[model samples]
Target: MSQSHTAVTPSVNKVVLAYSGGLDTSAIVPWLRETYDCEVIAFVADVGQGDEELEGIEAKALKSGASACYIVDLKDKFVNELIAPAMQAGCIYEEQYLLGTALARPVIAEAQVQVALEVGADAVCHGCTGKGNDQVRFESTFAALAPHLTVIAPWREWDMRSRQDLLNYLAERNIKTTASATKIYSRDANLWHISHEGGELEDPWNAPTDQVWTLSVSPQQAPDTTEVVDLTFDAGILTHVNGSAMTQTEALVALNSLGAAHGVGRIDIVENRLVGMKSRGCYETPGGAIWYQGLRGLEELVHDRPCQRLRHQLGQQLADVLYDGQWFTPVREALLAAVAVLAQKLTGTVRLGLYKGNITVLGRKSPFTLYSEAFATFEEDEVYQQKDAAGFIRLFSLSSRIRALKQGGLQ
Candidate 1:
């Protein structure tokens, strides 16, 4: 059951809403004004979901009864500040999800708060439902950044429960909306990836239909011949795609096109949500997959065994923190600092072959690579004395040897 925040709400004269111009937010603009008798300002964060989602957003907000709408272009900052660091650290939630939706929230929420303060708004509202992780992500950020502002979550207050209810409410109010009841999937898209949830995904046993995917083609529908992509990285940040230099954002855009052509990134998983429930989702992240693979290839050459293990641990921890909306904390900064050190020598080029939803490493090269042909040679090598390994192995296994002797199992 959704609890009502308005039962004993604080007085609010103006409120800023994180609006998407979608159904929920479209309804929310008018609801905030009617329910609280406050001025509603629509705030849209453009994190490169696509031009289609952004087109006519301002007009939609105005039609929905917003006093004004502020669209913040967060594309550059999203890739450079959030995605770059996470990508460099190899942060993938639950070993599968690329943290696509999770990574976009903090930057969007931070920008929302900034808009709220700029307009002297008393409250900040979001259309996130109470059952999901986004409510926590958005409100947690608000609490950390602006503790004083009142937070209004309509899902926790309104009687509306379904998309049908939202539609009926809009109709009663004579407000126009593009949403329809037949819209089966719930999708969230940004620069890195697109996520699909709801509908048939509610049943874990069900396989997603072809309609669930919007970004990349089905592997079966992919090209017959393999396409090779060359990725160059400097200090663990993507610097170029193919032979042409590009900004990180531009490189990602190009990579997305190339990888998607061959069906390079697609995953379906049942993941544990931050709210303590298992939910199934499908994700398409062609460019991000290529980016991650390129960095990993570089790490394989540059990272020593210990550094490799430590980086793996860092990735898991950082993923957890980011997924749980803890990105604004000191612990995340500390983890990023460690990742920066590990990534310092990760300048490299990785050649990958993409074909039918697969990415194969064709070659990897790094200036700081630890690989030595002379030492690793199968033939006799003067640089490494194989005979000396016996004593070193004995020393390394001394603890095990002592444990066996103590148990009288030395034989």
Candidate 2:
């Protein structure tokens, strides 16, 4: 039987929970009921994890004593409003996976807040662990959107020590769970990418096993043939592929098919978590991988070197702040402003080669491109300024020469 709730209890009349139908969230249902003596309204955000994951989520929530279950379909909004903007900015963490989970939080939290208002709930709850980045993400959104609602985080209050303990507790309470005692990996999936943790992935040096990947094939196992893909962008937004216009979601789906077949996007990194720990994870972001590279190619055609460098630097900083879940801050707004200006002229076409997990930019062109053939050609041309390089090189090396002279030439 599940133990009775004893930790911090809510005095509110009703609570809206961000339910996922997962092990932790399933346990949260009964625990919330017993502790708060309040009606629980479960809210599930469907952000394209597929029907299998969401099929019986509402039923499961109701079975666990929730007064009602609300499953909001946020797939279109998620892709257009959230994913598209991040893609335009070419945002990725550690030069690997797009910040999929991190980006999903704000939208999910927003939906949860709306549900809370619709159901007249006085509080909101989530299943995020104390050590995870999601706690910050969800809480920050709540702080920004519905600060009046009391925030309830079960992980910080529950005495559950492990997944095993949760299972045992649920079993004792006759709460059936499909989760087994020995789960080899912990995964978080969405339209963007699938993340793998635990098992071999927890060890930074260990190579990911085949069983760990659910999305893309291993590069070694990819086909021997190469594939070419063409992409078009307009005002920092992806539009056409191979002369066919596609919706944002459709474009991602097509890119994912091509990129995954070529083993294009797989990454393993030890990333710093918001909880002050470095966790190793393997990420597969096939579609996002191709899109980001393609966007950069277009950006390169239009933006000068100095501007590109500044934008890339800003991207790195934005990655850290986004990963840390500071999405509502003024700093984030300033960073996005910089990215918007940099991406304004990013309109062009990019041809890419995909072979055995490698995405290589073959060609890129743009109307606003700064590249000049007359100035770059090897043959003598009217625009040639060969003698001007002497002055340019001297000015560039002026600081170095002064530093050497001040240091006694060779000290």
Candidate 3:
């Protein structure tokens, strides 16, 4: 089925593939075995995409010609290790994307590499298309963690140009595939968010219809009543929701339900893909939006102006690094360390209101709050002297005054 122009050479005996039980990956299993003449092992990471996606995935993989299939549960690890740290640093790519798909790539790649080693596979493979960012993300991880293992990207070698080509190839080979040429959207989902692409979304001017959305209702259809939630964070980690202590995964699931009920987070943007193309995508990140707002509220209460400025800089840098698949590098580690220091005092509780795609901070309190009521009072108070501001203002503007005088602009 593969139309590789070059002469076929067997480079490896076995390969561990990053499989998702999807059409591309299902076709990839048989293609790898037939082309490479090697054993194929499938690796699946469950980052809480939901039970429907994972159910019978291993069986499907085995039936697709894989010698073995590994389905690892990465939900808690994903939320705690990847999602939590990114949230703390406020790492949103291009000021809009929550880095949901970007963040999950490295975690999935790392686990895939581990499975490859455990199974004694001589190489690793992925189902990512040549034009997408996941290819870079997966290969970069392979280059960092295990350079000795050969990396096989089938899409680069295969001549399949479209979804139809893949389906036809599989059909010719008598391999069953659930995907069809009429599929409207390409979707990727995890615990953090769901990303939708293709179909009407390819044209940026086209508005997404109701069928395009899965996680949340339309803002117009959202309930009229406002919902309030209490979130508690300790040392940059979300610890509780609405007076109940919970694990990182539990809290996210709870917040996702609440936020989705009110249509909290939905973004549609044309993003710059790592492959030098612009792609249109819509994302639903309900729980993540609420968490970001709550943490920002606490940050305002605790962090000073200088600290906040530096944190903002760190966030931008972290966003780029994470998006570029440089998570395993020293620069990412350094940035995370800096963010950790800034988040040391970010412990507090924040009450937030959710209504029709809006998140508003109702109240916030922190033990390390820098707000001083006496110094900030509008009425006359013993702690403040009104006349002191005259001298302070004069000194602050002295450079401007001197410049004006030298230019003969002031009498």
Candidate 4:
């Protein structure tokens, strides 16, 4: 294997670790201290995974031999800064994934870097495996933000391979972890969505059982009645849901509750990973689905064909950039710049109906809409000249007509 080389010094006196209070990360603290003879400071980012995942996380990190722990609440930043702009741009990877895991990484890594700088640590660490995209995402952000800081990825360097091995390592050191060999699925969760992999998901032929899902119910189990919610957007920023003003985070939480009851946002896809491998994953983005539909519906009313095409192209490019962990690059900033200009006209309200894993555009209304009732109506309208379409169609098809005539004469 190639060496995990960085330009920093070989001797690291202190390091900051991205801790999840899980089996691998818990073991990593003691391993780092023992191997490097350094003080370990744990950094935890709360991106609204849940109260259960975060409960007593600081104490858990301390128990794992971390000298100190800093748990930063990145929930607001996650929704507002990362998710809101992506939603406005309508970014969905492979036409299905709402980028739940992809969107969370940069913000989390940014916080991790901040903690490292604040404590004057010479190194930063993460527990991501070598096979996953997260390793790229975490390391890329770290490289962009703090190049001088050493990166310690224990999974790439350590001898421990299995969950039982990590558990045994922790046990031997008198460290405790709540993980077991019986754990079925590998999962990542944030405020936007939850992703499931490993377990039965390794094989694309196998379908996910109810146990694979933690956030939403099965489509069959969803309520029979349809539910409608009105979303209001100001300059492409979501401001209210169902007539109540809300922040970006509040709107998503409320929508998730409504959509989960209707089994709205669940997708199973075999996507191409950035590491040049295909992996199967099941993602649940209940609220994201509703927001995506609402934004697109509102876009239709406000954007003309050329403007709409530009927005669609921007979405595709943004998805690729985000999935590849290139968020801090100039390419992403350019895409967002266009999205910002387009969003100035994207002020509207859309009512969406959710039922049995389906989202329907009930209605759309916008002050900036280019759709004029007088021009579109079948009834005679004074504003539009019906005779003008004759000349327009002739000019539109002039090239085709000329080509056909010349070929006919030649034949």
Which structure among the candidates has the greatest lDDT?
A: 1
* Candidate 2 local Cα displacement, residue 184, angstroms: 1.7
**Which pairs clash in the backbone of model 3?**
none
Off by over 4 Å in 4: 1-9, 409-411
The stretch of ten residues in a row with the least summed lDDT in candidate 1 is 1-10
Task: Supply the TM-score for candidate 1.
Answer: 0.97
Across residues 1-411, which tens digit of lDDT does each residue of candidate 2 receive?
Answer: 445456656588899999889898998988888777789999999887878889888888888888899999887788887777777777778777588888788788999999999888999999998888999999988998889999998888777868998898788788887788888898888887878889977777788888988888888888897787889888888889877999888898888888888888888888878889888888888988899999888887888889888888888877777787777779888988888888789888999988898999999999889999988899889987799999999999999989988886854
Clashes of 2: 4
Per-model TM-score on C-alpha atoms: 0.97, 0.95, 0.98, 0.96
How does model 1 fare in lDDT?
0.92
- Candidate 2, RMSD to the unseen true structure: 1.8
Question: lDDT by residue for model 4 over 245-358, one digit each (tens)?
Answer: 999899999999988888989999999999989999999999999999999999999999999999999999999888989998899999999999999988989999988999
Give lDDT tens digits, candidate 1, residues 41-127: 999999999999999999999999999999999999999999999998999998888999999999999999999999999999999
For candidate 3, the per-residue lDDT at 132 reads 87
Cα lDDT for residue 387, model 1?
90
Residue pairs with clashing backbones, model 4: none
